[model samples]
Target: MRRLAALVSLLLLPLLLPTPAQAAATPLQVYGAWHCGDDACIWGNVRSTTDFDAKNHWLIDRGDGRPSVNVVVLSFVHPVKLLHKTTDAQTLDGVPRGMTADIVNYFAGRGIRVMLSIGGITYTTAWNSALAENAAQFGRNAAEVAQRLGVGIEIDYEENSKPDLVGLQAFIDAYRSVLPYDPSGANPAARLTIDLAAGDRWLIDIGRKATADWLRTDTPVLDYANAMVPARQPSSSDAIANWQEHLDGKPTYSPPIPPLAPAKFTGAFYIAEGNKVRAECADFTASLQKSTGSFVQTAAPKGAGLTPGMLGYMFWAAERPSTKGVTTTPPNSCEGGVGGGATAYAIPIPMPALRQS
Candidate 1:
């Protein structure tokens, strides 16, 4: 009788143990910042090494010989020009003059990953036109740029109201055809990703489609999605609420949107807000990154994902997001906020292997 009772207890012990999601959380794999210039997301001019490094040194060496983030995304490559394969004195092989190899090498040399963003809010019409014209070709062109630069590509098509989902799919397919998904993270060009709105409310169609089909862990399409920041900086509670929406999808929609895996995306915050240095860029303790750190690390999976916590954090506009906004340059660098956060999080440089599920 005693032996039988012990056997029963031993069998039930497995059930009592915490599931993977409830277990100890893992550190964030991705910590990135998007780079933009004063020219409204366009790096228009080719800058010399000295000039470029002077303004951007803070990114590479965050006060203590460490980088602020593991990755840097160069913002706003013209989709129309890339689609048309346009080239001129200002553009080379459909890439901007400013997005040169030297610039990419600057970061890559320092154990940082670099990516090129293909669209922004200002290029909504352009994205529509390009998708309408030749999305497959556009994807091929983007793949070509990625190959040439040895960098990854980010699809930032912010067509909230009427996104060209079909075209976007074709674009993704074509790009994947050229550079297939690489789980090993060896091929940089294979590291494709997309940008989603802060919450499931906006970018409804794209978000619905992305969450349902593209971002599935069983059969992944893009590497991941970025939950971009809202118009203004959101408080810790507001930001978590927004992130929670992605974890808990809307079921009442036409074809119910599914919950995204916590490992499949990163939450974004504003580094600076129009001439004002945000806490994310200036002060770590007061920053949303610090306030929301625990939630970001241990939030359990809702309906999808076996892992706890979202992928990691991403900061908005590294250099100068806008002409009017405070630039993340020199005296106003993100060493305190972003850098301190990096140290606090012990963010792995060159971005270690990410959790697939």
Candidate 2:
């Protein structure tokens, strides 16, 4: 009887242990900021388009194979205009200035998810009045951009000194209103997500309050929230600690902030850590998960090398190497160059479709 039980236990152990291939093929959303620049004229490989090309090329190599890294989100930046009412938007003709359909198509063909991120910390002022004064038009413009790009949308609204939750929600609501239920021509489930500042406790408070009502009513307001981890170690710890504390304690309003319950929700709580540039990402993810047990993805500027347990990454700067800081570029490279040669791994599950009930 003991021998028979041991044989049965051995059979179950293999089934329980997750293999690297299985882990690398889940829904990991890795993103990189891409740019259109004049650098292709020199160093051939160092050209501005190299990073963008290399990204897609990387996918071709990994397609249906044992893709250690899957699901790429390419952020197109540069002379690209996010605003609809601006003179450039009005004057520019033929698919809006700087938006190349060919480039967008290049990514989509590879089964990668490309998102147009509007209003980073640098250009956040664009929303100051747009959100406060006129939210309706903001939505219209955002939808139009999504339509033109044929990709999903993202709002990276990161303002620390003057974080306004009301204004932020207003902008998100406005954008949600205009977007069609199925914006992706190919994937109807694709929708918009907001990258909230992790450092701001006030912002988190407002988001939870808003999400409670939004979730109950089933408004297409917010699909997922990306919590931005600070650049330094202490900052990352503080961000996670405060968020966990808020979720775990206190009852200021109805429907208290939701704790990191793996059973109830699978929302993402991510942080950006230096790749090979710094060895803290693996440890950072481990500590945060220990605290909340939420899904985590390590955010790295474009070239940071891979870390263990990384769901995906968000690289800084659309333009790098040739284009320079026109966009915030990631420093460390797995491929060992500015052209993005670093190879990372993650599970490649198709992005869950957002259902509008």
Candidate 3:
């Protein structure tokens, strides 16, 4: 009987190897650290006068042989004013006052694909006005900046209370029109993405409306939705479940929005403040590693709805907070530091490969 049982277990192992429902066939790429860490983030909090210190803010490759997150969201292009935009520009406050193009190229030269995030939490009104006033121009401007700087675009629209679906879609259409996606990777190495609320409870309306069109079928304009972090204390379960339900909508949806394929989503979270690292964030990492259980990675589509898994994780930041003290010295402060945050998520959570694309 023991011998027979052993034989049966061995036979079942092969059957368990493939997760058919997974979004991608390859093991899901770990897309960690959607950083805007510390003063270097420039877009979030304005800090010291030096641009050199901001560039080396994050210490990604520590020479410890641990797998660190490969990508960092260079962060923030707040308050879009493209109506009179120019290729050479500076931040409103002039904190990151220097040649923006050179700063962008510095990271790219080191093999890190930097994505320029447009719209922060405070710039909701600006986003509304920018998209509503001139979506095409806004798109062109975004594309121009992305092209010239050789970076990608991340629309961090946090208008959960009253999201402008029409205007948002218009922006997507306009941006994609100018910077269209090509399947063969022939297009310039530019990535486009957006942020949605953590779950359906808060942004339920969007989950229903967007599933039918914006996210489900428009792969050329956007990559996947980064379900922004700072939900309930332990929001991973709800976040993952919301994405799961997104793939298969709830019964109560009015007009019943189309289900979003898992291939079109990624979970995001914070690595600072009340969001506990060991207890809270690590569980989120485990769930993401599991591909939210019901989800999987795939590349069969290769078109409008290409590749799979929850597209990957986006951490709140990659820099140690100012409260953590200037972890690194001057000159290197731009891309250095991790004082109290040494064992933070960087090496624990799987990081994306140096995203050169």
Top candidate, metric TM-score:
1
Q: What is the TM-score of each candidate against the true structure?
A: 0.92, 0.57, 0.68
Expressed as tens digits, the lDDT of each residue in 93-180 for candidate 1 is: 7788899999999999999999999988988899999999999999999999999999999999899887899999999999999999
Per-residue lDDT of 1-357 in model 3, one digit per residue for the tens?
999999999999988797666342444443545555455444434334355434443434433523234445665565454434633344533123332555555555545556767777767787887777777777777777777667777788777677777877777777788777543333433467677666555566666656556565543346556766654434446555655555555657565645555566666644443423432223433433333433434323323343444455555655443344332333322121222122333333323331121
Q: How much is the lDDT of residue 29 in candidate 3? A: 42
Q: Which stretches in model 1 have alpha-carbon errors above 4 Å?
A: 1-23
Per-residue lDDT over 1-357 for candidate 2, one digit per residue giving the tens place of the 0 to 100 score: 999999999989988898655222233343333232223211112223455555334333432332212233333221123444443432243122334556556555655556665555555565564566656556566666667667766666555555556766666666666664442334422466556444335456544643454322233345554444444444335644544442332344454554321111122222223222322212323333333323233222111112212233333322232343222222322222112211332333343332222
Off by over 4 Å in 3: 1-26, 40-59, 62-67, 86-99, 185-189, 217-220, 232-236, 275-308, 320-357
Deviation in Å, model 1, residue 215 alpha carbon: 0.9
Of models 1 and 3, which has the larger lDDT? 1
For candidate 3, the clash count comes to: 21
What are the runs in model 2 whose C-alpha is more than 4 Å off?
1-51, 54-81, 84-99, 161-170, 180-190, 199-206, 214-220, 233-332, 335-346, 349-357
Candidate with best lDDT:
1
